[model samples]
Target: MNNIENIRPLISVIMPAYNAENYIEDAINSVLSQSYEEWELIIIDDCSSDKTLKIAEKLSNNDSRLKLIKNSKNIGVSETRNKAINLALGEWIAFLDSDDLWENAKLEKQIAHANKVGASFVFTGSSYINKEGKPFKGVFEVPESVDFNKLKRQNVIPCSSVLVRKECFETIRMERDNMHEDYAAWLRILKSGILAFGVNEPLLVYRLSVSSKSGNKFKTIGMNYRVFRSIEMNPVSSVYFAGVNLVNSLKKYNKILFKNKKIKRLRLTNPL
Candidate 1:
């Protein structure tokens, strides 16, 4: 029998919360409802002025598996996640954002898929939900696998959908808060020839809100440029990749708009 079949490994879930009072409870409860129970959720509140810490405290008090850590000052998401990761004890590390949710079987399915395919890092496809929790028209599916170069074009890995071996962080820690830190880390690991596997199902529920930094695609252009530079790619190369990133981003948004328009037309033609 494979070693995976014989072992029930513990998964450490990292959640960095900052002024997430509106959605933190549902995020915590999603982990609480996971089919796979061998996990510990570490919620690190990045010194929010809101009730994020208080809400996490209340939930943590009820379950030993829930651990709440408070920061003395407000830090960015990358550092906040690094703090939780350092305190994590599990062999595997999974990231769940304060405002996103997982399907009940997300962990169970992703873990199994990773073990069966011998992938150290795994991410899942996600379906979109608005601030009020209403579903978007379609799911975002990821390719079965992607390497370092493939990911450089566009980032398909959603932070909330990541489940990776903890040891992968021995040489990789999220840095450069100005850019996508998670993307930087993944690129570094994949640069060392590690291939990431994707579970092409909507195992994650991503909340779309204007308040999020990524909500405004045009605003992230400079941030994406910094991502290539952080990886030490030359100025000319970085510019090219940044342009590629912008084009791909536009393509993704166009798809979303097309779907929405199609839905409106269908309603108009087939209304009861």
Candidate 2:
């Protein structure tokens, strides 16, 4: 055993898995490969009928640090993640989706940055990886430090790339019906006067699959409308956010249509 291992602070990684057999291993491996060695992987299986639960159980059995929790009934991602967070024993909490992955030095780098900057919460840039496992070149850029004013304009933080102090959960509660739970939680935290800092490094790979919940435009638009309405504000700001959300939804629809056309052309040529 190494001497440094004994002094390392415990980092609890909360992962909510649901029918993610194909990508779960990669997700687990990403955490296992982290340069920061003292961490626990808390995987909550949301009653997946697929091999996801079995695989998670196997991994937990192999590693003492990997803790597996099974839900008796199928709950949504928000509930599953909240349960995992409640069960975590670490001083710091990090979220990783079963279909996404982190770079090897992600935890170490982020922890160092947080400690140096004295930030309670930290998020990093991430590259988008398509279903075929090809990573896109562009990275999502967010403000280095967020305030309520900045967050109201846009939600640039990605949940899978976030690392926050465990105490943050005491103030921000996850909404079960909110499709973008991270954004909602961040807004709540910001409203409470806590500023979240961002790391510019692309330390995570956010997987984008055709079947992803966010891929549904109509559902996302509906959810955004709900989010705008949920915020405690005057009628004027509410209308402003609603209009901003509508334009954002239309932009996404246009991008999706263009991508679909390109995909159709490729299919015609390759016949795959």
Candidate 3:
């Protein structure tokens, strides 16, 4: 027989939230529904003006595993996440945006994979969900493994789907104030000679809100370029990598659009 109390938590989830009242509850519920029970969720409210903090507080009261941390002022997402990471107690740290969700088996499967291969960092595939919580067309499929060179061209790792060993951050932490800071952090990890593995299953449902920074495609492009140049410190390398990122991004969305069109055409022709 297995002893529940004897087993220490393997993962600590970090969620940095600001003005997430509309969908934050759903995100919390997703964690509550996880099949893996030995984990902790630390939700930091970044001085949200809305009911985001209140909701998180209410949920935390019901479960000891769920913790709520409120910021004194509106620190950005990067700082909020870093604070939570610094306080994390589990051997592994996982990220989940306040508005995104995970399938019940996500932690269970990812932890097994990590133990099997001894990977320091791992991410899974993710699909988009619209404001209405309906499945969208864009689905990100990542390669099996990524190194510094492969990641430089295109950052296919989704922050929300990642599970990283706690010690990996000993040398590098998330850049507190930068566009695409998560991308910069991942690049730093890979550059340090750590191999990141990707599980090909879509274990995350990333919410696409129009008001979000990443929802603005043009702004994201500029941010990607800035991240490469400013952090990577090579204008020529930045341009080459930025170009590859742009082209790959276009192909990803175009493929989604094409699939939607083909489905619509089939529906019209078959009257189904």
Question: Highest TM-score, which number?
Answer: 1
* lDDT of every model, 2 decimals: 0.84, 0.76, 0.80
How does each model score on TM-score? Answer: 0.92, 0.84, 0.88
lDDT tens string, model 1, 1-272? 87767677999999999999999999999999999999999999998999998999999999999998988988888999999989999999999989899999999998899888988999999887777787777777899999999999988888899999999998789996777788888888899899999999999988764343343454466677787898899988888887787787566655655766633211100000
- Which structure is stronger by TM-score: 2 or 3? 3
Clashing pairs for model 2 are none
- Pairs that collide, model 1: none
Ranked by TM-score, the better of candidates 1 and 3 is: 1
lDDT-sorted candidate list, best first: 1, 3, 2
- The CA lDDT at 160 in model 3 is 89
Model 1, position 78, has a per-residue lDDT of 93
